[model samples]
Target: MKGRETLSNRFEDGVLALLPRLRRFAIGLSRDRSDGDDLCQMTIERALSRRESYEPGTRLDSWMYRIMRNLWIDEQRARQRRSQTFASEEAGVSIGAVGGQEAAVEINDVDRALTSLPDDQREAVLLVMVEGYSYREAAEIVGCPVGTLNSRLVRGRDALLAKLGEVA
Candidate 1:
C-alpha cells in the first residue's frame, strides 16, 4: 500500500510537470480548444487511474501522449458512429510565445496551416516538429512504421510551406 501510494505521488508530480505539453498535444489532436481541454483532463484522469500499468524508468511523456492519442482516436470513432461533427473554433495563436503583432499573425497562419493538414499528417508534424519527438518515438506513439511517419512529415511540411506561401 505504501509503495503504491509513493508511486502514485511521483506519477502525479511527473504529470503535473507535463501538463502544458500534454495540453498542447491534445489541442493539436482534437483541433479545438474546448475539446482539447476536455481530452487533456480525461487523459490525466485515465493515467491516474491506471498508474500501476505505467512502467517505471520509461518516458512518462511518451506514455501520456499515447494515452491521449488513443483517447482522441476513440472519441473520433464514436463521433463518426454518431454522425456528429463539430465546427473547429479558430486555433488559439496566443498559445505560443507572442512577440508582436507580426509574430502573432505568423503564428496564427502557421496554426491554420497545421490544422488544415490531414489527421495523420497533422499528428506526425505535431509529434515531430512541434513536440520534438524523434521519428522512432513518434512512430511508436502513433503506432505507425517509421517510414510511414517520415512520409507523413514530409508531406505535411510541404503542405505547410505551400499554404504559408499563398498567405505571403
Candidate 2:
C-alpha cells in the first residue's frame, strides 16, 4: 500500500522532528540529565508503540507530549513512594557537564527557587515558560482548568521574584 507507506514515512519524520523539543521538555520535568534522558526514551518508546492510536489529522506533538507528561508523573510518584527524599544524590548520576562557578551559582539559585515551588505551580511555570506551551495547551497538558493554571502561574512568579530579590 503506497498510501500506508507514505503515511508511515510522514509519521516517522514528524516523530524525529519532535525529538529535541521532547528531550528539552523531559529535562525540565526531571531532576537530572539521566532521568531526563530516561524519560525521553520512555516517551519515544511509548509513542512509537502506540502509533496506531494516533489520529491521522490530529496534532502529533500534543499527543506525544501527553504521553511524556504522563510518564513523568508516574516517575515522580514512584520516586515519592520509594523515598520522600530531595537530596541531590537521589537525583541519580549527572549526565551533563557542570558549568563554571559563576554559571553554577546562577543555576543553583534558580534551581533552589524552582524546587521551592509547589509541584502544581512548578509544573505550570515550567510547562508554560520553560517548555513554551500556551496557556490553553499547558492547562490541557497539566489536566487543570485554565483559571487554576493562571493562579498557579501567578503564585509561581511571585514566589520566584521574592526568592530572587530585586535586581538592578
Candidate 3:
C-alpha cells in the first residue's frame, strides 16, 4: 500500500509538473482553445486512471504527450464519424461570431494557420518548434523516423509562413 501511494504521488507530481507544457501542446494540437482545454483535461484524467502503465524511470512528459496525441487522434476520428450527417464543407465559413478587431484577431489567425497544417506536420512543428524538443525526441514522440520528422518540419514551416503572411 505504501509503495502504491508513493507511485501515485509521483504520477500526480509528474502531471502537475508538466501541466503547463502539456496544455500549450494541447492548444497547438487542437488549435481551438476550448478543444485544447478539453483535450488536456481528458489526457490528465486518462493518465491518472492508467497510472500502472507508466514506467517510473521514463520521461513523464513524453509519456503524457503520447497519451495526449493518441487521445486527440481518437477524438478527431469520433468527430469525423459524427459529423458525417452534416455538411462540414459549409461549416468552415461560420467563424465563432466574435465582434470587432482586437488582439484576439491575431491569435485567431495564428491558430487558424496552425490548424490548417496536415496532422503530421502540425505535430512535428508543435513538438520541435513550439515545445523545443530535439529532432530525435520529437520524432519519437510522434512515432516517426528522424528524417520523416525533419521533412515534416520543413513542410510545416513553409506552410505556416505562407498562411501566417510572414513570407510575401
Clashes of each: 0, 0, 0
Predicted candidate 1 versus true structure: per-residue lDDT over 58-104, tens digit per residue: 99999999999988986776576344333234434444445778988
lDDT of 2 by residue, 37-117 (tens): 999999999988889999998999999999999988866755664463333673556523555686777778888999999
lDDT of 1 at 97: 43
The residue-by-residue lDDT of candidate 3 on 119-153, one tens digit each, is: 99999998878766669768877888999999999
RMSD of 1: 15.0
RMSD of 2: 13.9
Candidates, ranked, lDDT: 1, 3, 2
Best by TM-score: 3
Error of 2 at 17 (Å): 0.3
CA lDDT of each prediction against the hidden true structure: 0.89, 0.85, 0.87
Q: Relative to the unseen true structure, what is the C-alpha lDDT of residue 11 in candidate 2, on a scale of 0 to 100? A: 91
Candidate 1 lDDT for residue 158: 99
In model 3, pairs of residues that clash are: none
Worst 10 residues of 3 by lDDT: 81-90
Off by over 4 Å in 2: 84-168
